[model samples]
Target chain A: MARLREGLRVQLNVIQALTSRELMTRFGRENIGFLWIMVEPLLFAALVGIAWSFIRGPVNDEINVFAFVVTGYIPLTFLRHSFGRSAKIFVANSALLYHRQVKVLDFIFVRVLIESVGAMMAYMFAGIVLAFFGLFPFPADIGVLVLGWAIYIFFVLSLCTILAPVSEVSDVVEKLVPVSIYVSIPFSGVFNMASWLSPELREILMWSPLVSGMELMRYGLFGSAVTPYYDLGKAFGVSIVCLLIGLILCRRIRRTMTVT
Target chain B: MIETRNLHMDYRSGHVTKHVLKGVDFTIKPRDRIGLLGRNGAGKSTLIRLIGGVEMPTKGKVIRRMTCSWPLGFSGGFQGSLTGYDNARFISRIYDKNYSEMKEFVEEFTELGSNLKMPVKIYSSGMRARLAFALSLAIEFECYLIDEVIMVGDKSFQDKCKEEFFEKRPDRALLLASHSLETVQQYCNRAIVLKDGRATTYEDVSEAVAVYKKL
Candidate 1:
């Protein structure tokens, strides 16, 4: 028990150190460095929000189509940002492995954390801004909304974990991940809710943890205003399985990889 | 003490698998200044890397009871975009050492002056070596693994290093790998020579140096 606690402490120490170093490397100490994490997603959300508002003009007073798009868009933007950053991560930071204590998982986790936190901030900030303009409504239940976001973030992180290490070895994988991210965007339930689809289509789509996670978050935002179709057990089960496989891959790579 | 239990490491490049360390075993107790003498590609650095837990041995285990420093004078671990100070700060953070204290030592030891503020990628090889050496010394590792090419820079810098590192840390265990026989003889009380993926330790440094000369 004591050893486990000590190990956790050490791991946390390494992560904290890497986090600051990575921040400096990516953003630097210059003007609005870290804030850019939020901007990429915010810009995408803003553009989509505008397009949707123009097209639909809000079906009813209760459903703010712009708010719907922003909420859905933020997670998609996060997924895109994460996959974009995953390709060169291991090779670029392979040098840091010389420290012996800094694990490859720490590098993956730090980026996930940066993107997740950034996306969350952008979500709330976009909501506040859009609400100010009377184009959005606040989350009806913050707790459920956050729970849904956490599960979605976990799902995305699991996918990233699998992709990050694989990309390190295969150039083919590196090229394919970014393109796949764009191709999979529409299918991830970012633009439309599950209710918009027929029951058979919804059942098929919910098999994807990403789509199911999207429904849960949207449900949190709209409350009784919209019906959410998601299998909590299925979504969580898939994420946990992916997460396990990803962790095993991470460990396998550490031993097999040479610190060049 | 640090002990290796029949450690074996194989490196694969395409279809070729190079057997680096084959069932090599040794134990390093406190204050043992053991020089690692091997020709180029004789697996001196590879052994050091395994001992430091930077890489895994294919078929055996390394049991380290004492803290070991990463191969000293190695700059590959540094993030190139960070300044020298930031690099040092990163090490301090990982090791949980005091940053300001490490900063003072680095500034004084490296003598890179304002160059420490510049991104490490811009620094010359010599400047990088100084920062790397300084960062390693800042942490209090009981055992240190020195890479062969660490004897860099001018006479004064070398003298400062010997005075600060060698003379100061009398009781610390050291595994120094150098091509220079004189360096191996002067600093080490004993030595280990490598050949054909096997290691043979010599109780006398001169004997090890003599054996290394023939190989």
Candidate 2:
């Protein structure tokens, strides 16, 4: 018990150190600084919301366009931002690993954490702001929304852990990430709703853990305005599988790392 | 003491692989001042890194009961955008030391002056070395690993380094890896000569230096 407590203390200290370093290097003390994380997502969501409102018009009177877009786009943005940093995390922080207390897990987890909080703040603040303009309604079930967001974060983080180490060994993974990020926009469960599709199409999309999480989040917001198709069992199962695989992969990365 | 057994490190680039350390076994006892001698690619640095736990060995174990400092004067640990003081604070956080105390030591040791407030990328190489030296020393350790740290800066700076490290820490253990045989002979009581992916220990520093010169 004493050993576990000491280990936790060291881990917490290392986490704080790495987290501050990451934040300082990324945002610096310029105009707005770290506020960029929250603001950037809002901008992305708002821009897409406006575009969709212009192109498709109002699909249903019960649903707000901005709320629909915010729910999807902000979550997608979180994944993009998190995975984007995960790719070259080793190269950037490898020097700090010289400190025996600093581990590969610290770097991977800290980046995900910063991005996760940023997305959460952006999602909450966006809803309030959009509601003021009558563009979005307050979530009917904040509890469910939070739960869905947490699960999505878990799923994305597991993927990030895999990407962080995989990108180190494979040039193909590096090339694939950027292309996949762009390609995933439509299928990201952002602009598209699972309930809007045919049974076969919805079943195919439901195969994606991201889509499942997205539908859950959408249902939490839209309530009776739209139907949400998701299986919590499936989302949790796939995420656990990915998390285990990612951890196993990250553990093996030490063997492949350059000695000096 | 920090002990290692059958340590091996291999570097892979493209289709080729070069073995750096093979079955190298050694222990860093408390207060042991050891000089590491080897050729340019002799894995002197690699051995230090493995011992320091920066990188894991391919087929061995490193059991460090004693805390070890990072390769002294390694400037790579600093984030380019952060000021010298910020980096120091970050280090203090990682080591669970007091930030104010680390800053105080850094200000006195680095002599970076106002440069401590500026981004590290703008500083000269000498300034960085000084900052690295200050930060490393601020965090006390059982063992200090030096990898040709004296090669940087001018002669006076080198003298200051020798004084701060060799003179100040008389009882602290040190593993100094350098090409300068004079420095090694003067400070280290023992030596480890690395060659062909293996280590040979010498009780007499002069003997290891003699063997190192022939290699």
Candidate 3:
């Protein structure tokens, strides 16, 4: 028991250290440095929200296009960014493995953390900005929003866990990750509500943890005004399975990887 | 104490599988200065990497009972875009050492001065080596894994390194891998000669050097 506690403490220290390094290396010490973490995502979501609002002009009178885009894009950004970063993460940070205290999982964990935190901040910032303009409504169900976001974050982390290790072993997986994200965008439930889908399509889309998560998020934001179709149990179950598979694959890769 | 049990490592490039360490076994006790000797591609560095816990063996395990430093002169660990000070700070935090103290020690030791503020990638190879060596010394691990090419900069800098590793930390375990017999003879009491994916340890340094010369 004592040894386990000590191990956990050491792992935490390594994670903290790597987090600081990731921030510095990525953001640098220039103008507003780490602030860009929040700003970069916010700008991406804001631009997309405006463009999306203009592109799908007045489609649904009940829904605020700006709020819809902000809510959906924030989580989508987290997923896409996490996946994009996970590719070749292990290989890129191979130097860090030289330290006995640092593990391959630590690299993935740090990236996931950075993306999640950034996306969360962007979510709050966008909500505040839109609410100030009287365009975005305050979340009707903050509890549901938080819960849905947490589940989505878990799903992204699990997906990263799998990708980080697989990318280390295969160059093909690394090369295909970005393209895969673009292809999956439509089915990711970013632009359309689950209720808007036909019954046949909704059944297939509901199988996706991403769709379920987005549905829950929209339900939380728009409340009774929007109809949401999601099975929380199915989403949770799929996330758990993915998490287990990710952990197993990561463990196996750590055992065999040559940190050169 | 650090011990390796039947450690085997195989590297695969395309269709070729190079068996680096084939069931090699050894133990390193406290205060034991062992020299690792081998020809090029003889798995000398691979053995050090395995002992340092940087790489996993293909078919065995390394049991480490004490803290071990990474290969002392390896600059690959530093992020290229970050300044030298940032790299030192990162290492200090990870090792749970005093950040200000580590920075001071590295600054004094490396004497990089204004250069410390520049990105590490902009620094010369010698500068990177100096920073790595200084940071390793500041952390003060129980054992140090030194590669063959750690002797960087001029004679004064090399002397400083020797002083830091030998005079200052005499009781710490040293696993030095080098092709130079003189260095091994001067610093190590025991020697391990690696060949054909196996390692043979000799208590007498001269005898090990003699055997290594034959290979």
Best by DockQ: 1
Q: Highest TM-score: give the candidate number.
A: 1
lDDT of 3 by residue, B3-66 (tens): 9999999998889999999999989899999999999999988898888888788889999987
Question: Which residue window of length 10 is worst by lDDT in model 3 chain B?
Answer: B71-80
Ten-residue stretch with the least lDDT total in model 2 chain A: A29-38
Residue-wise C-alpha lDDT for candidate 2, range B1-215, written one tens digit per residue: 98889998988789999999999988889889899999999998888888877778889998988878887644556777788888888889988999898899899887778999999889887887888878878888878888787677678778787888778877688899999898899888899999999999999999998999899
Model 3 stretches astray by more than 4 angstroms: A31-57
Candidate 3 lDDT, A65-128, residue by residue in tens? 7778778777877888899999888778887788888888898899999989888888888788
Q: Best candidate, lDDT-wise? A: 3
Residue A133 accuracy (lDDT) in model 2: 89
Question: How does residue A50 of candidate 3 score in lDDT?
Answer: 79
Tell me the docking grade of candidate 2: medium
Q: How many clashes in each candidate?
A: 0, 0, 0
Q: Which should have the higher lDDT, number 2 or number 3? A: 3
Per-residue lDDT of candidate 2, residues A1-260 (tens digit) = 99999999999999998888877777766747557756776787788778987998877789877777777878988888888889967877777777778878899899999988878888878887788888887677877777788878989899988999999988788878878988877665888788788898877776577887787788788777778888788788888999899899888996577633
- Model 1, A1-260: lDDT tens per residue? 99999888888999898888877877776747556655655677678767866886757577777777778878987888788787767777887888877888888889888888878888888877788988777787877787888878899889888888888777899889778987887668887888899998888887678888888888888888888888788889989999999888878877878777
Model 2 / residue B151 / CA error / Å: 3.6
In terms of DockQ, which candidate is stronger, 1 or 2?
1
Better of 2 and 3 by DockQ: 3
> Number of clashing pairs, model 2?
0
